[model samples]
Target: MANSPHGGILKDLYIRDEPLKATLQAEAETLPHVVLTERQLCDLELILNGGFSPLQGFHTQAEYTSVVTTSRLPSGALWTIPIYLDINRAHLDTLGAVPGSRLTLRDPRDDQPLAIITISDIYTVDRTQEALQVYGTTDEAHPAVHYLRHNTRDTLVGGDVQAVNAPQHYDYVAIRRSPNEVRQLFKKLNWTRVVAFQTRNPMHRAHRELTVRAARMRHANVLIQPVVGLTKPGDIDHFTRVRVYQAIMPKYPNGMAQLSLLPLAMRMGGPREAVWHAIIRKNFGATHFIVGRDHAGPGSNSQGVDFYGPYEAQDLVLKYRDELDIEVVPFQMLTYLPDTDEYQPINEVAEGVKTLNISGTELRRRLKTGAPIPEWFSYPEVVRILREANPPRDHQGFTVFLTGLHASGKESIARALQVALNQEGGRSVSLLLGETIRQELSSELGYTKRERDINVARIGFVAAELTRSGAACIAAPIAPYNEARQQVRKQVARAGGFYLVHVATPLEACIKNDRAGVYARAIAGDIKGFTGIDDVYEAPSNADLVADVTKTSISQIVHEIILLLERDGYIGDR
Candidate 1:
C-alpha cells in the first residue's frame, strides 16, 4: 500500500461546485486581482494536486509560526516549509484585506483566474528571523534570503485558496506527474519499495551509479525526481536538464528506475529542505529517499563559505526519519575508480588506491574547451545532450555589452565591430546602439535611475533571448550604473557568455567630440539628468576590456574586442 500523506489526508481545493465557482469567478472580476508570482504558482498547483498534501492553501500566521519554529503544522503534522501569500503593504491597505476578505488570484503568465483566496490573517514579517530559521542564514547572498529581504513584500496575507483552475504548462505534459499521479504510477509499476532521488542538475554516470547503488542497498526501485520549477539562480535550466535526464534514462536497468518531473520551487533551505523533500517523496508513495552530501544545498555565500555543513542535510533527515515516514538512504560522494572501471563511495576506497573525479568547474572547462570527456566519467549520450545544451565556447552564442559616457565613441566602435563581425560571416550579429535602442526599445523611458535600470533590463532580456538562439548581440547602451550593468551581465551570462567592454573615453574628450550637441545641451542646463554632466557615471571596475577611444583608433578598438573574444573562445582566431 502507498504511504499515507504528510497530514494523513491530501488536501483538494479544486472548485467542484460549478455554480458557486462560476459565481466566484464572476465575483473575482469585481474584486482586486493578485497576480501569482512563479513561486506562488508552484505552491498553488502543488496544493491543488495534493503534492503539498496537507496544505489546503497559503498559511495563516499561527500555522506559519508553528511551521517555522517547529517544522510542523499547527495540527502537529510534518511540514518543514512555510507557504505564505505575501502582498505589498500598500496593496493590502488598498484592498482592505482583513479576516474574511476575498481576493482573486490570477496567473501572471496568462492572467487567467486560478483561485479565489479568502484572507485569514494579515501580519508583519521579520525577514531576518524567517531567513535565519528557515534557511539557517540571514545573509542576502542566499537566494531565498535575498528574495525575502528585497523582493518579497513587508506584509504577508494569509489565506485559504479555492482553486478555480490549475496553472497551465505547455511542456513535458507526460512526465509532469502530480502526487496522486505518481502514487498511481507506483501502483501500476508494482513499486512497493521505491527509493526517490531528487536533483536540480543533469544526471551523469556518477549520479546513475549513486542512485542505482542506493536502490540496491535498500532493495527498492529508483525514482529519479528532479525539480522542474524555480531552482537556485544559475542552475542549468529545467528544459535542458530534463533533456539530459531523458538521454540518461535508458542507461538505468530496465524496470529498476523511472523518471518524473517535480514542479518544486526550492528555497535551497539545506537541512530543513531535505526533510521537506522526504515528506514530499513519502506522499508520492516512495518508501525510501536518497539524501547525499550537501543535499539541496545552495553552493555558497558571498564569503565563499558553504551555507550548510556537508552532512547537515543527511543528519537532519535522519533525525526526522521516523516522523517523515520515508526511509532515509544516505549516501556519500561517489568517485570513479578508473582502474576498476566502476564507481564507489569516495570514503570506501583503499588507502593507496587511486580514484578519478571531475569537479563541476573542471567539467565545464572541459566542455568549453571541447576536451575529451572520457566514457568512464559519463555516457556518450549524456555527454552529447550536455554538449548540445552547452556548446563549446567558440561555437556558443555570446553578448558584448558596451557601457560608457553618452558621447564616448560607443556607437562608432559598435558599428565598426558589427561590420567587422559581419565581414567575418560566421554567426548572426545584432547591434543595439544607444540611440537606436533609446528610439526603439525605450522610447517612453526617461533618464531617471529607475527608468535607466528598466531600459538596461529590457536590453538584457533581448540580448539574453538572442544569445540563447545562438546570435551574437552587441548592446551599446550608456548603462552608467554599476549595479544595472552587473545585472545585465548576470542575465545574459545565463543564456551565453557575456563580455563587458568599457569604452572609457574621457568626459571632456566626449563633450568636445560631440556633433549632436546633446552633451553640450546637458552642460547648458537644457537637458536634465544627463549622464556624466550633472548625473554621475558609475564606471565598471571589472570590465573584460577597457578601450579608451581617445587613445585607440576605432579599428584598434574593434581589434581589441575581437582579440578578447578570441582569447575567451567566443570566436576563433581572426
Candidate 2:
C-alpha cells in the first residue's frame, strides 16, 4: 500500500462549498490584497491541492521559527522547509493588517483572487538567520540565499488560508494531478509498491537507465515526477523539459512507469530538500523515493565549494527513513560502458573497462556548438528535442546592453553596432536608443531612480522578447544603477546571451562632448535629480566590455563589440 502522508492526514484546503467560495470571493474583492510572487503562487497551489499535506496555510512566526531552528513543526512533525507569506513593511502597513483581519492573495499575472487569509500573526523575521538555518549559507551566491536577502520581503503574515479557487494552470492539464487524483490513479493501477524519481532536469539515456535499475532493485513501479515550477535560475525552462519528458515516456516499459508534474518551488537546499522531496512524494502516494548524489544541490558557492556533500542527501533521507514511512532508494553516478552497451554505478564498474559520461556543462557546450552527441550518451529523440529548444549559438538570440553617463557616445556606438550586425546579415538587429525608448515607452516617467529603473526594465522586456524570437537586440540606455542593469541582464539571459558594455567616458569628456547641453543645465541647477549631477550614476562593475569613446572611434568600439560577440559564439565569423 502507498505510505501515508507526512502527518497521517492529507490537508486539502480547497473550499468545495459553492456558496461559501462565492461569498469569500466577493469579500476578497473588497479586502486589501497582496500580489503573490511566482514562488508564492507555486507554494499556494501545492498547499491547496494537498501536495504539501499536513499544513493548511502559511506558517505563523512560531511555526516558522520552530521549522527553521529544529527542522520540525511545532507539533514535532519533520517539516524542514518554512512556508511564508512574505510582505514588505510598506505593504503590511497599507493593508493595516492585524490579528483577526482578512487579506486577499491575488495572482500577479492577473488580478484574480486565489485565496483569502485570516491574519493570525504579523511579524518580521531575521532573514540572515533564516537563510543560515534553512539553506545553510548566508552567502548571496546561493540562489535561495540571494532570494532570501533580496527578492523576498522582510515581514511575514501568517494565517489560515481559505482557497476561493485553485491557482489556474493552462499547461499540461492532463498530467498535472492533485494528490488525491494521483492516489486514485495508483489505486486503479494496483500499484502498491511505487518508487518515485524526482528530477528538475531533462532526462537522458543514463537517467532512464538509473531509474529503471532503481525500480527493479526496489521491486516497484516508477513515478517520474519532474518539477515544472521554479527551479535553479539557469536550468532549462519547463516547457522544453516537459516535451522531452513526453518523448521519453514510451521508452519506459509498459505499465511500469507513470509521469506527473509537480509545481514545486525548489530551494536547492540539498540534504534537507531531499527529505522534503521524499515526504512530498509519499503524500503523492509513492512507497519509495530515489535520492541520488548531491540531490537538489545548488552548484557551488562564491568560494568554489559545494554547499553539501555528494552523499549528504542520501544520508539525510536514510536518517529519516523510519519516520518518513517511505523507502529511500539511493543511487550513485551512473556511466555507460560502450563495450557492454549498458550502464553501471561508478563504484560497480571494473577497473580496466572503459566508461563514458557527460557532465551537464559539457552537454550544454555541445548543444550550443552543435557538436555531435554520441548515441550512447542520449537518445536521438531526446537530443533532437534539446537541440530544437537550444539552437546553435550563432542561430540563437542575444542582447547587447550599453550603459554609461549621458552624451558618452553610447547611442552612436549602438547605432554603429546595429549597422554592423545588419551588414553581417545572419539575424535581424534592433537598436533601442534611450531617448527613443523614453518618448515611446515611458513618456510620463521622469529621471528619478525608480522611474529610470522602470524605463530600463521596459527596454529589457522588449529586448528579451526580441532575443527570444531569435533576433539581436542592442539597447543603449544610460542604465545608471547597477541593480537595474543586473536586472536587465537577468531578463535577457533567460532567452540567450546578454553582454553589458560600459562606455566609461569620464565626466569631463561627457561635458565636453555634450550636444544637448542637459549636463550643463543640471550642473547649473536648472535640473533637479539629474543623473551624474544631483543624482549619482552607479557604473556597472560587471560589464562584459568597457569602451572609452575618447580613446577610440565609434566604428572601432563597435568592431570591438562585434569581436566580443564572435568570441563568445553569439555570432559566427564573417
Candidate 3:
C-alpha cells in the first residue's frame, strides 16, 4: 500500500484490509459508464496528490446473504430484515447533490464498517428551472406562500442573493460537500446497516407510523430527514413545513431519529426522484431510504403509471443497494382511521370510506385557514409549524459575518476596508478599518490580541448593521480570534464564501513598525499589556496569503491586497 503509485495518502487513507476498490472496479468495471463530475475530478486529483484520503471499508455479503436477527432500533422493530432492492437505474436517482440516495455501497451487519462501491459522478445534469411546476393548488389564502412573503419583510440582512445565489434544480442534484467533510460525516459514523424512510408530506400520524414501523423492521436508527423545499404540483410551502417539523420534533422517539431539511426545486420525475432521494440520503449519512408511488411526480402524468409504483422504487433501491450503501424501507400507503381516531397503515385499516385519505389538495386547504389539525391525522406540533411556514412572497436580507486575522490583510486583501469612504462612494464593498476601531479600545490597556478579537465582534455588530443598510463594508481589526472568526465566517458563508487574509507581519517588524506606538509602549513598559508582548498570536497556517509587511512597503502591501481582492473576484478581475 505504501509503495502504491497514488503516493503517501494511501497510508493515511482508510485502507481496507481487502481492497474493495479492486473488486468494486471489477464488478462495476463494465456497468453503465461512470463519469466524474468537476468536483469529483478535483477530488480524484487531490487523492492522487496525496491531499485527500478515501474512506476504508470492510467487505460484507449482505446482498448475497439474507438478514439474520438483531434488536429493534429506537423505533422498536426487529433489525436486519430482508428489504427489496433495485439493481439498475443509475443506482439511486440523483446525481449532483440533491438529498436522496446518489451512490450506494454495502455495510456490515453491525453497521460499523462500510464498503465503498459506487459514487455520484458526472457534472452534466438537467438545469431546466421551470418555476416549481408542482402538484396541488393553494387554497383561498395560500398560506404557505403568504408565510414566505410575510417573513421575508424587513429582517434587514446583508450579502448578494444573486451573484452568489444559486437556485436548485432536481435533475442536477450534485454532491454538495467536499470529499473530506463527506468522509467525516457520512462514512465515519457507525451506520453501515440501516433503513431509510422518505416523506413528501409533513409529519402526519400515519407518516410517523410508517417510519416507526420501518425502524422496527430493520432494527436500524431512523433518519427522518424530511424534504424541506418545493414539492410536486401544489406542494406545501417549505417554510411552513419546516415550522411544523420543528414543532413535531419531540414526538419522535429521542435518540433513534434525527432530522435534516432538504432544499429542492420540484420536477415531476417521480421514479427518477426516488433514485435521487436515495443518493441524497447517502450523502447525508443514511444507509437506507423510503420510496413509493409517484416518488417525484409533478401533478399526475397522462399515462397514469403514477410516475413509478412503490415497488419500482423498491427495486431501484435494491438493485443499487451496494452503490447506495443504504437500504430502502418501502412502506405501502398509510391511512387514518376515523372510528379509532388514530392513524394506521393501509394494510391494517378496515375496508371502505373509514380509511382516511391524505391529499396535498386537502392538506393545503386545511393549512390555508388557521384550522385545528387533529393528532390522529397529523401530529399537533407539526401543524403549529405549518401555520408559520404557510405563506409566500419576497424575502428580506440575510446575514454576513467576516473572518480572518486583523493584520492578515483579509480586509485589505479584500480591500473590504476602504480608508476613504468618500473615494468612490458608489461601490458596494465598504471598508471597516481595524486601525480606526482600535480607538474604540484605548491603547492604554495595551490590550491582548484576544481582547482585540472580542472587540472585533463587538464591532462586527456595527459591520453587520452597516451591511443591512445596503452597503457591503470592508472591515479590518487586528482580530486574533480563530473561533470568533469561524463564527462570523459561517454566518457569511451562507451568504457567500468568507475572504480571509492573514496579514503575516513578523513580530520583530510589526512591533518595530507600529504606527500606533503600541510596540514602543509595550517595550518601554508604558503599556504593561500589548498583543504580542503580554499575549499570543496563533499564526494562520492556511491563510490566503502571508503579507510580509516586514519586507513590503505600505503601497506595495496595498497593491498585494488589491490583487487578492481581484483574485477572489470580490472586485473586477485585475
Candidate 4:
C-alpha cells in the first residue's frame, strides 16, 4: 500500500483505519527557536539593510567605530563621548551566543561552554544614528566617521533618577528624526574600545576627575551620559544639570570625549542597577561603564553602609562581565583638594590634611539656603546647576526628618504618609489622625485593645482616604504587629498601593544610636511605653521594602521609599 509508506507511523497508514492514520506523516524535528517581534523584525530589517560589512561581532571594531576617545581633552589624557543605548544591545546580547537558538557555543576566550538562550519578547531600542567624523579626528573628510545615537525609551539602564522630566519645569527633549538624513551613515568609522559613564548627578570636577582617571587607566574613550529624568527630589534637575555638563564640554580634552543626555526612569536598586547600567552603556557602543562608591544612589537611600559598598557593584560586573562584554572601570570616589584647589583622587588626599568636607547635600543645601558653592566643592558650571535647581526649600519634611530617636524614624515615615487633603496646595484639611479604636470608648490606654479591631479600623481609614483620593495613603502610630501590617497591606492592595517598609534597626543598634539617650534613661527607669520594651514592637515578616536606618541617611531612605513607591506602581515613575 503505497510501498508501506516509510516507517512505523507511516506504515500504520497501511491499515487506513486508525484515527489520523490515513493522513500522510512528515518528520519535522523540533528544536529550540527564537521568536521575533514586530519591533525586532524591524530592527533586523534595518540591520540587514544596513548591510553587514565584514561584521564579526557586536563590539567588532572592524564593523563599527567606538567613538569616545577623541572627544574629550588634554589631547589623549581624558575622553568622553555621547551614549546611545541601542548600540549597547549588540554588546550584551551577542557575546558568546548564537541567534535563534538556545545552544550557546563555547567561549573563544577561555574555551568554556556558553549558555544558549532563545529570544523572547523583544523590546524596541529607541535610537537614531547620524554620521560624523569618527574617533580621534576633527577632519570632516576623514575615511572613518562617528555616528551620533540615543535610545528612545525612557528607562535609564543602570542608574537611579534624581527627579523626573516635567513639562512645565524642564525643557522637554525633542523626539524628532533628523531633517537631513544620511543613508549608510556609519559605514566609514574604525572602532576602538569605548567607555561609558553613567550619572544621575550633574557632572562636576570630582566626577570629571574620576572619569579621566578611569579613561587613562583603561586606555579607552569616555562617554558622559547623564540621566535626563526624575532625579531625587531637591537634587539638581536635568535641565540645569544638562547645561552644566554642556558648559564643561569646552574644558574637556577636545575630540577625546562627548556629552549626551540619556532619557531614562531610574530604579535606584544599587548593585543590580550597576549591572543594568553597564549593559546600557555597552548598547550605546561603550566598552566600559564606570562603577564608583554609591554609584547609583539618588538619595542616601536606606543603604546604611553605602549601597552595598563600592566593591560590590564592581564584583557583580566582573562576575558577569562575559555576559555583558562591557568592562568594569572601578575607582575610589573623587574628592576636591583645597590646598591646591583641584580635584584629586580620594586615596591621594594625603592622610587627613584636606578633609574635604563638601558633599552633594552640603552643596545643594548651601545653594538652596542662599550660600555660594565653593570652588572646592564643584566646577563653576556645576554650581550654576545647583543654584538654578536650588529653587525653594521646604523644611516641614526636615524637622520630623531630624528627630533624634528610633521611634522618631518610625513615627516620621508613618506620619509622612499624607492624604489628598494634606496635599501641599490642596487647601483641604491637611493632617487627619487615623486611628482604629476611638479613645472615647476606651478606658484602659495601652492594654485593652488586645490587637482586636485595631489594624482593621486603621486600614479602613487609610484605604478609604486612598480610594477617595485615588492616591496612596499613610497610617502612622507604630504598626508593630505583623498581622496588623498584613491587614493594612491587603486593604491597601485592593484600594491602590500597599508597601510595608519596615524602617528597622536592631534593638542594640537603636540603643547605641539613641541620640536622645532614651535607651540609657529607659534602663534607669525613666521613660516608659518605649517600643521594643514596655510597648511590644513585633518585627515585620516579609516586608515589601526595608529602610534600615541603622547606617543609612534620611535622604537615602527617602530615595528608597520613592523607588519602592514607583516599583509598586503607587506613585508615578518620575
Q: Each prediction's Cα lDDT score?
A: 0.87, 0.90, 0.45, 0.45
Following a full C-alpha superposition, what root-mean-square deviation does model 1 have from the true structure?
3.0
What ranking emerges by lDDT with the best candidate at the front? 2, 1, 4, 3
Candidate 4, 265-330: lDDT as tens digits: 454444555765665554445667788876564333233333345566677666766655557777
> Highest lDDT: which candidate?
2
TM-scores of the candidates in the order shown: 0.90, 0.89, 0.37, 0.39
lDDT by residue (tens digit), candidate 2, 464-572 = 9999999999999889899988988999998888999999999999999998899889999999988888888898888899999999999999999999989988888
State the lDDT at 456 in candidate 4.
Answer: 42
Model 3 TM: 0.37
Best candidate (score: TM-score): 1
Assess the local accuracy of residue 173 in candidate 3 as a C-alpha lDDT between 0 and 100. Answer: 41
- Name the 10 consecutive residues with the lowest summed lDDT in model 4: 4-13
Angstrom error of the Cα, residue 469, model 2: value is 2.2
Q: Cα-based RMSD of the predictions, in order? A: 3.0, 3.3, 21.5, 20.7
Question: Model 4: what TM-score?
Answer: 0.39
In angstroms, how far off is 551's CA in candidate 4? 46
* Candidate 2: worst-modelled 10 consecutive residues by lDDT: 1-10
Give per-candidate clash totals: 0, 0, 88, 49
Question: In terms of lDDT, which candidate is stronger, 2 or 4?
Answer: 2
Of 1 and 4, the candidate ranking higher by lDDT: 1
